[model samples]
Target chain A: MTDNKYAFFIGCLIPYRELAYEISARRIAKKLGIKLITMPDANCCGLPIDPVNHEMSIALAARNLCIAEDMGLNIITLCNGCFATLTKTNKQLKKDRELRQRVNKYLADISLEFKGSIEVKHFIEILAEDVGIEKLSELVTKPFNDLKVAEHYGCHFLRPHKYLETENPENPTVLTKLIELTGATVVDYLDESECCGGTVLGIDPNIPLSLARDKLKNIKEAGAEAIITICPNCHMIYDLNQPRIEKTFSETYGLPVLHYPQLLGLAMGITPEELALDELRVKADKVLSRLVEEIKVKH
Target chain B: MSNEVKTYRKPLRIDPEFKNLVLKMPGGETLKICFQCGTCTSSCPIAQIIDTYRPNQLMRLAQFGLKDKVLSSKTIWLCAACATCVDRCPQGVEMASVLRVLKNLAVKEGCVPRVFKDFGSAILKTGFVYNIPKTRTKKREDAGLPPLSKTKIEDIKKLAEKTGFIDTIKGEESDDRQ
Candidate 1:
């Protein structure tokens, strides 16, 4: 049986830019009886520095793993980048004694060691595997039966399938299945598994913008009233940068982008205000109003 | 108009030992396995939009032991590290990891990008990639969220120092002076 307690590893992006994701995630996790103990003295997950120094990246990630090891809890991260980096590092250090000793040498300076006794999981993984869909379905008091949305898994969540080993990266159904659990219609769009180009946004903004434009176009054309994303970077590319993309392409696609937790939260009878729905760049009034109207008709 | 035909110049030299160097790195174990099926390039989202960035060509360049050409090229930095290439490679080449090995070599050669240097320094200072502003941290309480965890900067610095991250960035600074 999987543990209900987790060492919360809130990566840089969520605290810095994507508060709504964290806000909703904490709410849903609390509602599900998942105890989150804030990991103290956690550093960056080491993705940004991976390109410059692979060893250093591994060491940084190992440091975070050591913290969770100290806490005696499995690590749970909100960001896909953090989830992938930490999970890969944890698996690598566990299997490779040489790599572990190398990273442990660095950790020794900080008075820590990577025993690799703990596991790392993304928040969604816990919900699906530990919480179970039946429990989630039972908790839903206000299912959006008429809501239609597209799901973006983002690259780091499932790709590099060898390391992740979660779902088929080419045609992932985990996120789609989770979306369906909220009683929302999951619209199948062209190139459903495409990258959001967020990873390259720092190197070249135009590439991600073009990629987001195409995704938004496809999502819109498929009759999705909104787009759902689990990764903060993908959310930034779609929701935060949606206006920038529309302006650059001289097109119109004002599709609301919701964090999966926000969608699930709404389905569980959580109010939009509690989910921080107003913080979204593109207004979700259409989805929100539909929910309100559904309640009115029921009353 | 003077008819000046610009001749394409091949790389002056190739380091045959470079493949061995890549093979020694953590993610470079499968460097010799790539058969250049172009699956990675076709699967890449960045490559789909940016014609100049191709993963298979980079893999081929590294496989051929063209160290200088592969390390100094800007295209090596273009990989988003999405791992689509890594997953789709039928040869089990792990293209993303191989690209990271190339990037690490480039950083060692003092060809580090400005943004990466900024990221390194930021981590050293704040323990996070982007520094969380004090105002934002304070606002967390208003949002009914707990205070952000304070990172032990001294421990991070020690880890960074022991890993030679300090030296790598220092090496880049010295390169700038030259």
Candidate 2:
């Protein structure tokens, strides 16, 4: 029985750009009794080039699916982009025979075949569904004590509802409910479903900077101490670009952006070192220090 | 007062087959069904922030068979692919997917944005957009995680050639070096 085992597919970003996200996710999954088996030879999830070449995008995603099928385990993706492409291609291939035949023919060159048996899920899905919020709350050693944080629902996690039915597109409650389990309050902000604008960062970076600045403006106005993100790309845009956004917009909003995994790890009583929280571009010191003070009084 | 109807005209070249051409492309079949309601534009996150990116106008251009104008505009490249507009469309018009089709068409027509071409070349060469630096590998090792794996370059190259990606990026590689 493939009960809790998952073929972990960490796309390009987390391994290089966002190590803290990967570290915390692994540490938390271990504590939750879930097994994540890394597929070493997995390539990019093909989202970065989806617009340029649809065929290449689908083929790359199919190759990863085939790799997971060989292990006889479902996929658990860390990045939202990976989840979108994998789920989209998996659904497309299962429903469209011609597409399946074409992708399989391409895979034949690499000695792989996509059978479409394996399922692809975001790490949040596994947490919300498999772990169950109540059990997650029970495992929390240090609650956020009403730390107000905003949730940035990265685009691919909830949209294209025909394929991704995990949450409502307009107003998602899964990420909010999961955050509540950490004892943190999800602050409401404008355009919560707003794109992080990372997609156009390369074409015209100033646009994303302004967009991120706008989102941060709303986040700060809502009195959020930090922002929580599901996708590394969003995290990079928000966390890594906070200073740049400040420089560009001539404002100061030092809102710490944490990956949901990092926040969950903190509540699970995992130390900062284990989660690699120190490596975050925007420091979570204010939030972490508050927790430290609360823990001191509790003891 | 002169009671005359002054008809002003500017030359417009419309390709009646352009709409059909777009319909034949993957994700472009629904190009004709868009009612030009501006819902896609209003719902688009990028469109709201960036004044130049108008999804509704782009759709109109596509439907009008303004091939050159529709494909060359920076607006098509500005869509973040958030799917908000697609989900919000009352007519079930997959605006994001249609935009993808337009972007691919733009590339074949040799009007792709410089950034996209650079990203494509990087993918063609390494199978990953960005190379994982040695410092990053050390950090991953410190965190008790396995180092990032190297992709099978030969297989990726084979797939690219079959998908015409190799040809798309043929001359662009040398141009990037300078």
| TM-scores for all predictions | 0.95, 0.94
Candidate 2 lDDT, tens digit per residue, B67-106? 8777766567888888988788999888989999998887
- Full-model lDDT, candidate 1: 0.85
Candidate 2 lDDT by residue in tens digits, A1-299? 39899999999888768888888999989998899998867888888888878888888899889889998999999898899989999999999898899888888899988887989999999999998888888877777775899999898998888777777888789899999877788889987788888888877788788889889999999999999999999999999989998988789999999999899889878898888888888889877865533442332
Best by TM-score: 1
Please provide, for model 1 over A210-284, each residue's C-alpha lDDT reduced to its tens digit, 9 standing for 90 to 100.
989989999989999999999999999999999999999999998999999999999888989899998899999
- Who wins the DockQ comparison? 1
Model 2 clashes, total count: 0
Per-candidate iRMS values, in order, are 2.2, 2.1
Q: How well is candidate 1 docked (DockQ)?
A: 0.63
Model 2 CAPRI rating: medium
Model 2: lDDT to the true structure = 0.83
Taking chain A by itself, what TM-score does each prediction score?
0.96, 0.96
What is the TM-score of each candidate's chain B when compared with the real chain B? 0.89, 0.86
Those runs of model 2 whose alpha carbons end farther than 4 Å from true positions after fitting are: A292-299, B1-10, B171-178
